[model samples]
Target: MSGANKVQKREADAEPVPGLFTLVLHTHLPWLAHHGRWPVGEEWLYQSWSACYLPLVRVLRTLAAENRRHLITLGVTPVVAAQLDDPYCLQGMQHWLANWQLRAVEAATMRTASGASPASEPKALRQFGSREHTEAERELAEFDALWRHGASPALRELLDGEVIELLGGPLAHPFQPLLNPRLREFALREGLADAAHRFAHSPTGIWAPECAYSPGMEAGYADAGVSHFMVDGPSLHGDTALGRPVGDSGVVAFGRDLQVSYRVWSPKSGYPGHAAYRDFHTYDHATGLKPARVTGRAVPSEEKAPYDPARADAAVDVHVADFVETVRQRLSAESARIGRPAHVVAAFDTELFGHWWYEGPVWLERVLRALPAAGVRVGTLSDAIADGFVGSPVELPPSSWGSGKDWQVWSGEQVADLVQLNSEVVDTALSTVDKALARGGSLDAPTPRDFVADQILRETLLTVSSDWPFMVSKDSAADYARYRAHLHAHATREISAALASGRDDHAQRLAEGWNRADGLFGALDARRLPGR
Candidate 1:
């Protein structure tokens, strides 16, 4: 075989290489279906589903069909999974996609009417509109044939093929570090069960929301049947090449290799900022489509250049090469430092690939295909754990992969009221439900499930989602976040009060009404709730 043929043969065959590389993508969104739209709501779900979920999953499926093993590990969080499987969301998403197609035609016909252009402005957007219409049509057809059932089957297909390892998280993505221990345990257990119910397989690994940890969380992990989880590199503080057991718990904590992860995304800089990539913030207001590239940090949205796929693809190639080199160098350096083959984990939010960074998916495909050829072994987190990529127990401080590297993001002074309010709501919901349960067996007592209690639990759990406080603290949609939190709190309080005051008819009405709006986790039987 020629030299080129020899390289191709190596890629077509799987064998151990110099060092291990794993990519972890945490997939999550707050319960958004039927919650709101436009500025932030179900639109969020459909947009991610179309742009991120569809393309990313297809990439993995294609690779798996080629018999590639251990592509990546994914955390399809419970709240997100609920929305993905909800019938209302599936119907709503299809409608949104069809509308997207129609809107493209409208944009092409009415560029002057489309806010992105003026009568005097060149109709450069016709091309963008045409491209989007094609994308919309493709997604809509694919969705009809494959995704009508939900995201579960798509993900399970990958899991069954061993293309990915599935990691699940709590029902609401709560900040477990500061949450009540019993509630935290319940949420994790229920979250795992939710995944098993939807996908027909329980995840042995978990992507703890925000990769947050508080010393004894590993004990909770061991109890919950989680064999391994992830934390940021800072949590390890010394060496991050190998996974470490937390204290005495047998469960392992893999530390993300920041050197590798930050090469792709960070607070101040990353590959997404490349001038040729599509700009996330800029949009054509009329059609709600983005047509600009990140020309520069100071460029205004209107002044930015229109997106060029060819240019963006060139940038993707450069970045993919850069990232692959970064991985190879890091693996080589870490192996030398540890005196053994090292595991380098590059973890990122799944949304970045196609939503926030337009070229991310393409870059990912090239990088993954290129890495093994560079003498680096690529595999999922589970593969690392099973291969004994673990070290001695390490004492970890209470930490979260958020600002300031502590619990400040979720329980900071900036959102002290939310913190206090969360405590109150959690306490009230638990106590009220417990009291109702205790009064059971009497003819007057509420039935074992009452399901109104389920609403109280569901709505209260939504109230405590970490997204609210994080959004509030960041002031990024603070008002909307506050509205959602308060909405759930009111539902919990109203239903609890009705049940307490012996207004069974009124409580049933409220529960049924709320159930239509926020009914997720059909498997969540509130009678089994394990808290005060």
Candidate 2:
């Protein structure tokens, strides 16, 4: 069938007896390059690149090649984009791809060594050449081939081709709901501009960090030229008939379909944890690498076996089919109930595809292909809004995809110290800005706009990221999280103090230090904010 006919047929099949379904995917990761390498930071970047970014780009490229017009919208935050385009990140990803190839070679060598002289080796070593071992070698080879090429061209191609509508968010994916209004406003505006400059496409929508929403955030979106943003279904009070405009701002808020999104990846349970998928934790102590099955229940670290991609691929296919069916059923049912087509938006963190859930890319490809086959149409959020679906009029409660779909994950008792620190530092920076501005250029040489901007940038970065306390609460690299929080906090505090003291040398030094550490948000100029 012709591609357009196929899409029309799918849309016809998905027409709810009565509502519309929209699918929005969020793509974000913090700036990890030049920070740390193997153990945690850079490894995060490399793994996600291997599993998600590269595969996603390939999927879009293939669809475009076939003239399929698979309309999918992706939100890539400025922090994530900065890292993707960073020289350090580019070089590190290349090294990471090369290292995977080396691992494949090593796995093959180990298998051959064990097979050539089985009796001469220890009894425990005989299993090294078993079927599972051979499968591991094959999977690594496949993985290496997929990522050996650089990711830039593929990423650029998607953006340039308009295969996917790009969405931008605040620098560092900050939880803007709780942030200082002026600072938040500055972050959002600059972030969108930065995205436009980098991707060569001005984004009309934003993926609010964490899908977190607040009443007045729409005003900020409007200021940034964003006409729409997304939130979870519950945030819209369980209605998805159409997007609701926030206040007088000409922006639409698209709520995510929690039910459908959870089918793919949820906080507590999802397809990624299936026994057949690759396990994220529990790597081999000898190689310091991940090599085991999810196995449903956690296995002892010592007993975990090498990763078997073949097994994982089987699981991906099954899950993909199930996911496609879920989408089909939801869309069909919603359309019938509403007496009009309704959108079923299934939103998720892009990192889940390749970084945490190793087989995510395979599932993504299968789902994209299956959706059309199952008579379900694909589209971007912009397409849905442009089509005239209006959301119900309801006051959205403040919420995020965090624990309990609330803000506690970022501000709970476990993270009270960090939260309080963030609050105080932000207040101090604001106060300093007020004082400096009030003095009318008489505050000891007057803090340079860049100096003030740097302080705002530092405080903004420190306050915006939901990562700090998330790490602490989960106890996953708590020390690193705490250290980063303090690093940003101290910079905020010191810069405020230096400005308050009217010390030029100290202010310059502090600004330079903060700039050197967390410098991705160069686009943020606090002076640009009204009355600054």
Candidate 3:
């Protein structure tokens, strides 16, 4: 057989037999508000809200409207959920949606005038009054009206309405495997509690931060009432089974199917990189914004023209149909092959929706609609587990979807200085906690030593996050990564100095400084854990 034919045959044959297909979307971003705003801060939050959140909610609502139980699982990290539920975020998202409507109108006006010559009396003016332009204006007007209402209430309504299964992860979306065990436990517990409080129900599953996994992490999840969580493909020894329990915790770990997941959003190559999609990196210098399709590899930014939503919307429909058909075929064939049902799980970062892939939300909605018509059932992780799909027992090797699927991206030599600082912070904080607890010191009360210890814990966790080094390695907002690392490192150093000197005044001042700079995690009390 020819190589192309063989490839086509393989693609046609790769279907899940006798199994369910699951889609898990991880929605998370670090605390960007109050930290950074313009070039890369609130804009990041608002762009994601416009592209991913609002659209996703719309899709779920549409499914609900049809009286169809379209089961899909979603992970909203504590930090991201906190920002989404905040009044500022709710207001900001409304304003952002309004601006999007204005931009769409502006695009429509520009397209209507495309035939006009600079010196002419405007032949395009007649085109602007045409039926198509009027319809475009009406669509934009409707779009603006839909999202003009507050996003928080809509989000809360989605959760309350059972449109999608909500999942939670550790506070700040830290890579848990590399975190200090005590701090990791605290973060996981607090994260679950925070989700329960905010959403009015405890999340039974977690999208482990970055899909990173380790052996003993299950105990923490089990203790925190998490019934199921997700890991990368390799973490489950290449098995695409659902609800595999780790240890005696009864917490099920679902491994992602690499083939299905990479089809939509891979690190090196994916559907989103297709030439038809909008180019994320290259933007027009004139407008200081992204306004072109990725025509081809050699197409330069200056040569690219303004984006046409009509053209992009058509592309989204094609991709969505392909995706839905792919899922349907895989599920049907897999069910027949396995004698029992089989599952194909596809997972991806939520930021890829609107923030990275401009028309992702459109694709998402179409896919949701297409799946039911194809006879494929969509389910959440908990639904799969509750149905009793126990996977084979296997020891998951250490893994992350970061560079090389190892710690190199986060703990690589490039960030050796920051890594060393993190190590020292963890060690010193552990030592201080151990010493204070051994001497009958009270964690509930505020003492000079206790305050310093708390500060050290907060700074240690902040500096130790894999996000800083990972961002630096990718060169996406490298300066912001460096600043965050330095800030946390400084806090670590000052606290260490105060502890070593046994000076109450200096310790208090250091704690105060750290608190003033960033104080979200200061409330964390790690002493409650056993043997602390």
Candidate 4:
């Protein structure tokens, strides 16, 4: 039989694959809008935006035009959405793209100015600057046409078309397990509200920050109106064949199938680590370009081979086929073992695709298109729930997607100081605000919140972000993380002191100063937020 006929035959012969397959991509970044550029701040945002978000949007739009639905489940945290829609960040991204093109042009000119021939230079190195220049130009055009105002319109288009299922999360991406109940609820409520404000539709599910779970979070999710959430597979005893209901809340927990997800990325062994793919760690400091491949382990940079896109494309094709078959066989096995339909949820960071893997977007586009032809039923988490992926009740343990599948990364001995610092700021902010609200009699009804109280809450939430401790423990951008944590903690302390000292003027000034830079949730009304 021909290829198309074989697909048709498989569709007829297979027992509907017994379930569904969904890929979940979590999009997040700490507030970096005004947090400096170069080396590691706003640059991180623009690079990812251009390299990942823009291209992914294009890929989805192409699929959407074909009426393809539920292509992926995308979770954009409120903090990330805030930055994308911020006027300042949007404008800065445009200039950054233009600068990229300019640098590429400079790279070409320098090549011509040099006395050496193209034969003397590595082909990839010789072409890297020009490739970047062209990419930058294309990105700028796309930005002007689609993202000039912000990412809201582009995102809303995808959501409305059902090309993507939107999953919202808490403000600042806080480590909810350690947060006070009052603040946790507030963040969830406000975070969903922020998504609604941006996309005109609230998400039914959330990609919980780090997938960190305490015992009673399901109740909080139910209260916040979340119908489902994604957690690491081990959270459900390594049995992730379905979205299991937690307690009696009607909220479902979908465990990521590590067997499938790790195929795309893992600490050791994955598609990106293949020698044919681009090496993310190597960079051209002069041009800010990457022009090498993962030649091998312990290979010096000078000896590393230049990146060849043709070779990478070939590798992508092979990996895409391998991944599809892996999912197919896994689903078939799970269905036979369980005597029912089985669902597989594969989740990963959004930046891993284009930013880290370079050819990730291409592989994703190909895989999404190929899975259906291979007899796999692809759908979103909601579609799965609607189609009966909800299974038996399961009690979840305290778990995270981090190393060891526990909270050690955020709460371990290495990060004890950060954990203590987070606790201190959270307590101070809650106490100061609760007392002030009681004194003003606002605890009983809607009343105007003071600027100091508002700033304190914002600082406390920012200070408690999980990124700080993770960065500190991993030693990646540790200094910046440390600086940011203490910066917010100090702000909370100063604001709380001003509120306690009865210096309203100084408090207002401090709030205003902080608001100028540290403000993210511009519409977060502190008075209306619920407290325990």
Candidate 5:
């Protein structure tokens, strides 16, 4: 055959590139609209917005501009989505961006006539600030253009344009394993409705809060119309080469392929630890910039090497090549072992990209582009299902992507009080709503909108968020986590107490007061809440 004919013959005989690769990014944050700012609360939201959301969206948009479809599955929790779309948060984000610009300008102009600091130090600070100022302006422009009206428009565009497959999760991202069954069902249904409200499309896949799953939760998934959900590899006994249909339900569970995933991020090593990457923890106090590279894991902040973008770009290229090879090899090996084309799923937190690792966005863009070029097929979870990446049905164990691959992170001794608090709060809130609805003389009677019941549910949901307990268990911002948990629990208790004691006026007032801070998910109807 001629050269062109030979190439065509080979293409016609190729066996679908061995397997498919799917990337799942779970994007979540607790509601922080009217929450406190500074070292803990809304600051977390704003920083992730600037560093992770804005840049990550830019990369995805760039890829979309190239006509890449089904790029990845992105899970935006209902709580985070509500905050992103809230007027309070939009205004707060604008102020945060403006303040960031001002800080950058200050650092850039801080050189004194006496030059108290070393000459090299001032030069580095000035350069860092100038670079940050330019990046900040770019972010501001992107935010105003695409995200000013909240993330809905931008996210909707991505969905409508088929740039990504969006995943929706339970309201407030409660740890489902421990929730009252009624509350769990209610939360998941309301959460899907919320996503549908914002994006005009209901998501069939969810990044289950912390990927926590319990036996028979697939029934809930089937009830909620969820087609697929993610779980950690251990949940499937590490047989993660294909999606397993849990029980008899149609809901499929895709386990993260740790062999391929840990190549980029794991406990001991990852690309982010490379010497050329920007250090995440070593902040320059004078300028508020992470001005150093990792250099050596043991190197102190003061002795770390200055961050060099060119070097970081070089590292990204190297890692991209490495990751592409890793995926290619894994897919080949797994396909051989499974005796068919296998699936490789790598899941991560979206914030880890730009917030935790500065060069992550660049590396992400490069690897995504490089994978397909290296003869590996890339797609979303939905695409995997469509392409026959599922296997025989397998029963999943109670599991989570936490310490010990179990529920201890949220239910362990460190958070035993929180577990009890959640239990009492959920039980009280449900009974109160149930009683109020029944007291209307007819259980099915049409009654006036129960704003008090709505607030109670809101507080109850907020109190049970997996974040609070996870934070306490991990000792990351434990004080703030405990404070939030207690605050929400108090609202749940006080509101339920007043309403249960025939103090209608007091309940309404308390509900209104809490509504200012915790009011979200306007679609949550107390009448729809099932009786315990």
Candidate 6:
């Protein structure tokens, strides 16, 4: 049978396969508007936008056009949603896209060719430029047409069409394990609300920031109307064939199938390391574009072979077949072991596609199509639950998808200072907001515009973001992480102090200035700040 006919037969089969598979992609980035550029700031946001978001959306739209549904589960944190829809970021992204096209032109014209080390590669650089220029034009046109308004419109299109399931999390991606309970609840409530405001649909699932879980968080998830969430496989003790209920709550916790997930990405190896794939680290200095492939493990970046699109495409085909066979065997084995149809889930960061792994999106699109053709069932987490891919209740312990599958990454000795800073600043801000509300005799009323309390809460939330601690622990842009944490902590302190001192005018000015930078989650109100 033809490929299309095979897919139709598989979809039409009333008796399902022995198991099911679901892919989850968690999308997140800290608030970067009004932050620095280049080394670390808006540049991170723009690069992800042009590379990952643009192409990933294209792939989804293509699949949707073919009437595909529940292709994947997409968890977009409210912090990222805010940046995608913000006016400043929207305008900045346009300039970034246009600049990329210009850079491509410069590369093709040899206006900025480097003179160091390589003399036999001018032709290769020009070819790379031509390819990039074409890609940039396509991305720019897509941006101007579908994404000009912000991410919401296009995202709503996918959500409304049932092309994907959207997952929502707290306003800022805070590590809920160490966060104050009240603040945690408040952030989650506002976050779901922000999602509803933007997408016109509130998500019933969340990515839960780092897959971090503390035991009673299930109750919190239940309270926020979250029906399910993701956790690492080790948290489920490796029995990851189905979703498990947490501590008597109706909410389900799905664990990533590390056996299958690590096939695509692991600490030491994955498909991205294949010799024919594009090299992510090696760049041509002349045009600031990567031009090499992973020629070999021992090969130096300068000596790596020039990337060939056809070679990488062939590699994608091979990797897709391998992944399909892996999932098939896994599902078959797990079903026999459990004496029932099994469920397998693999989750990763959305930015991994086309951002970190250059050919990731293509591989993803092919895999989604290939799985069903191979008689393997695929669906979202919600679909899996509805289809009864659930098991006995599990009393999950304190865990996160971090280095040690524990809280050490965010709360370890390496970040003890950040943990302490978060605790002290959160306490001070909460108390200050409480007193301010009490004095107003309007503790339950909506917060007024320019209220010092709003900005105080904003900065406080930003101060405790999970990104800072993760960056510090991993030493990836550690200085930028420290700078951001301290910056927000300082803002929270200054604003809270101004309000406490009855310097209303000064506090308002400070709040306004800060809002010009971090003013997201407009629906957030001081009255919603839960008191300890």
Best by lDDT: 6
Please report how far candidate 6 places residue 391 from its true position, in Å.
0.5
Which runs of model 6 end up more than 4 angstroms from their true locations? 1-16, 111-120, 442-450
C-alpha RMSD of each candidate structure in angstroms: 2.7, 5.0, 7.4, 3.0, 3.6, 2.1
Reference-based lDDT, residue 252, model 6 = 98
Q: lDDT tens digits, residues 444-526, model 5?
A: 65666789999999999999999999999989999999999999999999999999999999999999999998889988988
Candidate 2: tens digits of C-alpha lDDT, residues 1-532:
9865665566566533323455567887666665677577888887776667776776676677766563588888888777776666766777676666555444334432232222213232333224334544443454455433433345556767767788888777777777778778767877888887776678888898888877777766776788988887787777765678776676888888877888877777889888877677765333334556676565654555445567778888888888877877787777777777777888888888777887777777667766766666677788788777765445668887777878887878999898788778777877776776566455467534656655655555755487877888889888888877787777777777877888857887878776675666666666665454
Index of the highest-TM-score prediction: 6
**Model 4 ranges with Cα > 4 A deviation:** 1-16, 112-123, 439-446
At residue 220, give the lDDT of candidate 4: 92
Candidate 1 error regions (>4 Å):
1-17, 110-121, 441-447
In model 3, which regions exceed 4 Å deviation?
Answer: 1-18, 87-153, 432-456, 495-530
Which pairs clash inside model 6? none
Which residue pairs in model 1 clash with each other?
Answer: none
lDDT of each: 0.85, 0.70, 0.68, 0.86, 0.88, 0.90
The residue ranges of model 2 lying beyond 4 angstroms of the native Cα positions read 1-21, 111-156, 247-250, 298-301, 304-307, 434-452
lDDT by residue for model 4 (106-132), tens: 665554322122211444456766677
Residues 4-91 of candidate 1 have per-residue lDDT tens digits of: 4565677667344466899999999899877889788888888888889888987887677666779888889999898888888999
lDDT of 3 by residue, 1-532 (tens): 9643543454455542355677888888776656677777788888777567766776777667655453578888887776776656667766665565554444434533332222111222223223234533443454466544434456567777777788887777777877778778877887787777776778888888877877777777877888888888777776665557886777778888887788788877777777778777664332224556676667666455445567677788788877877777666665566556777788888888877887787787667655654556667777787676766555667787776776677777887776777777777767766665555545886433366666776776677666787788888898998898777777877777776677757887888876665565434564553455
**How high a TM-score does candidate 6 get?**
0.96
Predicted structure 1, TM vs. truth: 0.95
User: Which one wins by TM-score: 2 or 4?
Assistant: 4
